[model samples]
Target: MHDTKVTTDVMNPDCIVIGYNEIDFAEHARRKRAEKGKSGGYHDLLTNSVLLGGERRTYMDLLNIVRERTTGCPSRLSAFELPSLGVAYLTSFLRRRGFSAAPVNSFNSATEQLREMLAGSPRAVAITTTYYVYDEPIQQIVRFVREQNPDVPIIVGGPRIQNLCSDQSPESRDGRLRPLGADIYINSTQGEDTLAAVLAALRDKGGDLSRTPNLIYRDPAAPDGPMLHTLTTVENNDLDENAVDWSYFDPSYYAPTAYMRTSRSCSFGCAFCNYPALAGPLNLSDLSTIEKELRYLCDHGVRNLIFVDDTFNVPLPRFKKICRMMIENKFDLKWISFFRCSNADDEAFDLMAEAGCTAVFLGIESGDQRILKNMTKFAKTDRYEYGIRELTRRGIATLASIIVGFPGETEESVKNTVAFLNRTQPTFYNVMLYYHDVLAPIENQREKYGIVGSGYAWRHSTMSWQEATDWKDYLVRNVNGPALMPGYGLSLWTLPYLLANGMTMEETVEFIKGASRLVIKGLDTDYLDPEPEIEEILRGLAAVRDGAGQGASS
Candidate 1:
């Protein structure tokens, strides 16, 4: 379905928000990916060799691994895919403030009608960014906006443009701003109020940006251009306190799935991730607020729901209560969400199943106990295994999300992971390589781990970036299950469409196994057909990895 919901105040929207550089899998891209699926074994290896640099690995080492049919290599086609929830969250808030907000989805999507929208003279344009991967597309979008409507104020936010830069000196931060040319660089995670205020002020034209809070902006009077302006840092402790209006987009315009979060921020301070720092602290929504939201979505014909909470089952008692509410209310919805192995209890899983939880994505970061410890997962590998086994037994499909290539990762640690995967064998597996974040928990103790550098481009004590990537490739092939390539994994927006339409986990695995290509669009989450619940997609991947490892040994 095309996104053609023309807003009433479209010509002069209080704000026109744009999200750019998303991987748009059209008919042609899918057809091309399907064709590459034909090459099978050679294609997998070649993809890995081409995508992963040959730094630490010798030419022969690379050649040998390629010959063995590595399972997890994300052919050169792999890239980062950001969740679209950010823009939705911002727009919902803007509307709550009684300001008109329209979304321009991507650079391509926006470029098509941006000039037309610009003609409408939006009070301001806000663009939310995610990973650094979107920098190129963001630059283009910003340049185009400036050229088309130079006077219209531009506001930018999201993880990629937050606190880390907010703390830097003006020249340093301006260095980043010089490329994008955004009028206002919003850098805090407590965005709802911050963004709404900016749009409200922009609507009044003479409002002081410096008075708004936690921003790096071009002061019109400043010589070097942008300067940091800090008001009280926004700390909206009440997670579910505000009214988040999701009425901006038509329900049918998106994929069948409707995603919600009962909480904001994560309490667990995993060293490798920067989310906790951004989110501030773990906080939950009042059950009443949740019921209201869920009932609203259901009333609007959104039955396939997913919670995008970093840890859906945390604050165990609250999660259980919500489940009961869903059951008692007879909420006609089937759902999927992320869960932590430590929090997966018998009652929780039972309530989830009864509440129509067909699937869960668990962050099973590593199989090695030491690696798990280093990652601060806290829970033992056995706990992870138990959670997986329990979920599967309850007829709940599980996708264990793994991140390989931590600072201290090694061959033996990966072997431990392989064994863990073989034992648990999740319905599907998603493996992503560890990337560096100087502001994350890992960077806090960089010297302890011998980490040096800004981004994932760092010097670790024991493992080179190349070596870490090699191990990641090893895990994907070694981990038993239908391992999804990086940036191409399933997303909340599409998960419900797949499940509600009868795309069983088994069929998804087989489709993945048979294709054997670098799938960026993720196993066609849009298409669906009925099949059995259980299958061995990971089994084949594990076998290939095992045979390859054995061949190399001999």
Candidate 2:
């Protein structure tokens, strides 16, 4: 088992940073979570169990759920743990500045795990609310921290904090902050420096945080309320200066892979996108620094990389140069990226393959030209086929991501999407029901689409949200593809992850086929009954996971 304990005193870490993951669990937390599991069906366990948020359960919880649904099923599944890149960066940046910090990666927020971390008694505790975490989990973490050490300041920051900063009134901010119960919130794109300053302030400034940039905190003494606001904006980090400190992560615990961002923000402003607005303007990393980071990863025994840049191949010249740099370095690494199908030439594909690109994720969004235009995707429908064909022809895997409903979506448009998929034939495909985020550019044009409601319940002119979901289910069941990966988190780095854990492309495809079958079966039922078919599929995955070599044929 990997060392689950945070080695605080070894480095005398100045702060403890916690990253919350809902399903993935560290080895130590697995047994504890499973022991808490109750008898239930697979779907019930999945939705009701919370590894961190929503329902609190882990893989062991899943095993218990499955066992309850099947006779003589195994007691456990192998651990699936992956560190958070954001948390890793924060830890590394702190350590690099002479402040020791320990990272508790893939934490499931179990009470025992919290006790282990609090045992170190670090100066401050920082929680990153990046992705997949909700209010219940945040409140839980904050409540426990206060219970253990009321005086120790709890700091919270991430995408949520960045978004909340848009409203600056003390009363308005206090109303929002009162529930989570954090002492501070950082609203900066790069909070490494701001966080460091906050830690230093806690030690040196008698708990005064007035000077920290991009910060919002509560001060009961203030006449305005308990929350005091600091408005100084912190500039984005110089990529070269803030390279990920890989020392904080275990190369083996993750999928022999690392997630890197060569740039920040996205260049294109697709109508459905909120990333560009949230991330500000595009900022590219220095090429020399990029080369150095690649070399470091190679030296550290990392076998693969997932470039997290929003448009990794944008500004095609820079893209080609990065490819060429990887080639020139003679690095022994395979990579994947979020790709734009347009403005790409044959040379780029060739260069990517030669540089060891094993797969790519294309956010194709829509198949019909009309839908594409309405979404402001800025990609030609024809070029998507060309890109998929070229990439697949070169032995590279492609994941085609689609959004079912947009403002202008119609039944005919849905058929066109299916036709487009059948014609192009990517290595994998996934369909998602469109979600209406208030911050997305599409919100500005809601009346144009005759939209009402918000989030998943949203509807526009040609289709209602429920229709989109039904169509999504239809596409998943009806579409013919090599594999249908889960549309959401699967794109969140699944290809490299599968490969990183030693599954061959063929093996991975088989596993996905089994998962797809389970999805189909789950959709057809209320998911309360014990299903032999689903049970059989689970056994096949378990066999593959245990290195039995072959997956059960679908």
- Full-model lDDT, candidate 2: 0.70
**Pairs with steric clashes in candidate 1:** 11-120, 436-456, 480-538, 481-538, 482-538
Evaluate candidate 1 by giving its C-alpha RMSD to the native, one decimal.
Answer: 10.0
Cα lDDT computed for each candidate against the true fold: 0.64, 0.70
lDDT tens per residue, model 2, 151-261: 667898888776565535766767776788888888777677899999998878887888887888878475346677787675677777888856555555343667787
For model 1, the run of ten residues with the poorest summed lDDT: 50-59
RMSD per prediction, one decimal? 10.0, 6.3
Q: Pick the candidate with the highest lDDT.
A: 2
Tens digit of per-residue lDDT, candidate 1, span 182-226: 788777776667888787667675757767876777777773644
TM-score of each: 0.79, 0.84
